[model samples]
Target: MAEQPKGRLVDVELDDTIGRATPDVEHERNVAIFDLIEENVFNPAGAPENGRFKLKLSLVDKRLVFDIRNEADEPLVTHILSLTPFRKVIKDYFMICDSYYEAIRSATPQQIEAIDMGRRGIHNDGSTTLMERLKGKIDVDLDTARRLFTLICVLQWRN
Candidate 1:
């Protein structure tokens, strides 16, 4: 059987221009980064060879950019994606997250759980959309995509 192509992220950076995110947003960003570094699949299409990579994510001119490089710090590939497809999903995710957070403070357990379920659903939608948009550019599993989507939403927080 042919071996599956796999790549891990050695380093991840989010651009400074993303601005000061809320405490909750920062926590989510940190958690996503940590989880992604711990385990991920980041095989960029047309890479020179199979190996771990470094990633710098940023928004430029309303486009989401993936700046990928090798462990040696050599540039590998860059993929730019339109933010249009993500607008609604990201907005919905934020709304649901806000509701979830607020619910935790006052809502009943069942209410909080319900809001959390909606949050997860929107998150999943964003993750699936991310994977589709990255098609032919990079390959990442659903979990990785979900974490990456969280980071993307952080970037969109101030934009």
Candidate 2:
């Protein structure tokens, strides 16, 4: 088996224009960020070997920007991806997340489980798409991709 890349996110910053987000969204962001920092694989294409990385995520001119840096705050790779490809999946994920959250309030256990399954499915799809988009720009494992996808979803949330 190939050796897994060993890198983690030391810090993360999100540039969001949507003001404050919902409690659920904020919680999701916090969990994702915490989990991401605790464990992750981040290898910027063409960058020299580094122990940990810092990432600044932002949406500029409808493009998703990944401003990555090394531990010493030195510049690394900056990947800019089009948001068009992620539109449909993100929309679907948000819809399913809404259903899952609402199900927790009034639905039976079975119903909540079913909705949660759907939510996970959508989340997986979004993560896969994210990996594909970052294929040549950055390398990340599926778990890292999923957590980053959650943060990206939070960025799209509006007040």
Candidate 3:
């Protein structure tokens, strides 16, 4: 379980904490909590070339839920759920640019699976959901429970 820092979430940013260093590397090194809040960011010029999808980051009780809206105009296009193409592009883009990027880009399937499993563990502890464990079982004071829930919700897993 991640430590519940003694401050508000809105007050913190990765850049402020790590200065000019690569935020992803710093995060990996420190095992920091990461939340990728990819909102519409209002691409009034219009969404991505592949159309728009609602990417919401919100507090559900204390959990930061990644609500991804799946919408596509073409059936021939593979669905975004697999995320393989997205992963490929990210890797290819970084691979062309920097050697350091290799660490992040060339992560083994085992590493990816472990990351996914960690998230699943947090979200699904055996038969009990994370929300249930934090709120109902894990022994803690009322305030700690409230804050811990908030922390867990906001921490997200991403490519």
Candidate 4:
């Protein structure tokens, strides 16, 4: 006998029903994460508080998931370089901040002044732009300056 076409062999009536199709329990598990970043190297008004920038890292079913929330009003291009710390959970967020600024904000006299004032007249015994101090001819953008300031602050805070 010729092979019959493979069809539903036992076709009676299979009720393909899924339980809990309409459930409120799913909504209860939903959560919203808020992240905040402040770039306030010039003044304290824009400094971000601890835990303001939230990054969520979780593993689900053998897959890694990352949730990053930045609650900043202005985006990266407008700000160029925002001196925000990064969490391992969120990839490329802070790196973008660093690169975007370094590519755009070159050393300016105003930034030189601000850094000098912030550092308490500690630039080459006078007013020397960040680029001038490096002696490497690298573009000293606002991000680099802010990073130096942050590192200094961290060191001092540790002391």
Highest lDDT among the candidates is held by which one? Answer: 1
Steric clash count of candidate 3: 5
Ranking by lDDT: 1, 2, 3, 4
What TM-score against the true fold does each predicted structure earn? Answer: 0.96, 0.94, 0.20, 0.19
Poorest lDDT segment (10 consecutive residues) of candidate 3 = 36-45
lDDT of 2 by residue, 1-159 (tens): 978567678998888665779899999989999999988888887776556899998888888889999989988878899989899999999899989899999999999999999899989999999999999888899999999999889888842
Of candidates 4 and 1, the better by lDDT: 1
Off by over 4 Å in 2: 1-4
Give the whole-model CA lDDT for all candidates, comma-separated: 0.91, 0.88, 0.32, 0.27
TM-score ranking, high to low:
1, 2, 3, 4
Q: Per-residue lDDT for 1-159 in model 3, tens only?
A: 975322112111221321333565444423323321221111112223333433333333333333334343222111112222233333433343243345347878776566555444332332133233333212233332333222332232221
Off by over 4 Å in 4: 1-129
Tens-place lDDT digits, model 4, residues 1-159 = 974222110111111121221222112112101001123111111223221222233333322222323334222111111112222212232233234345446757676555445344332221133323333322233443433333222222222
Among the numbered candidates, top TM-score falls to 1
Error of 3 at 71 (Å): 25
Tens-place lDDT digits, model 1, residues 24-110: 888998999999999898888887545789999999999999999999999988889999999999989988998999999999999
Q: After superposition, how far is residue 9 of candidate 2 from its true place, in Å?
A: 1.3
RMSD of each: 1.1, 1.5, 18.5, 25.7
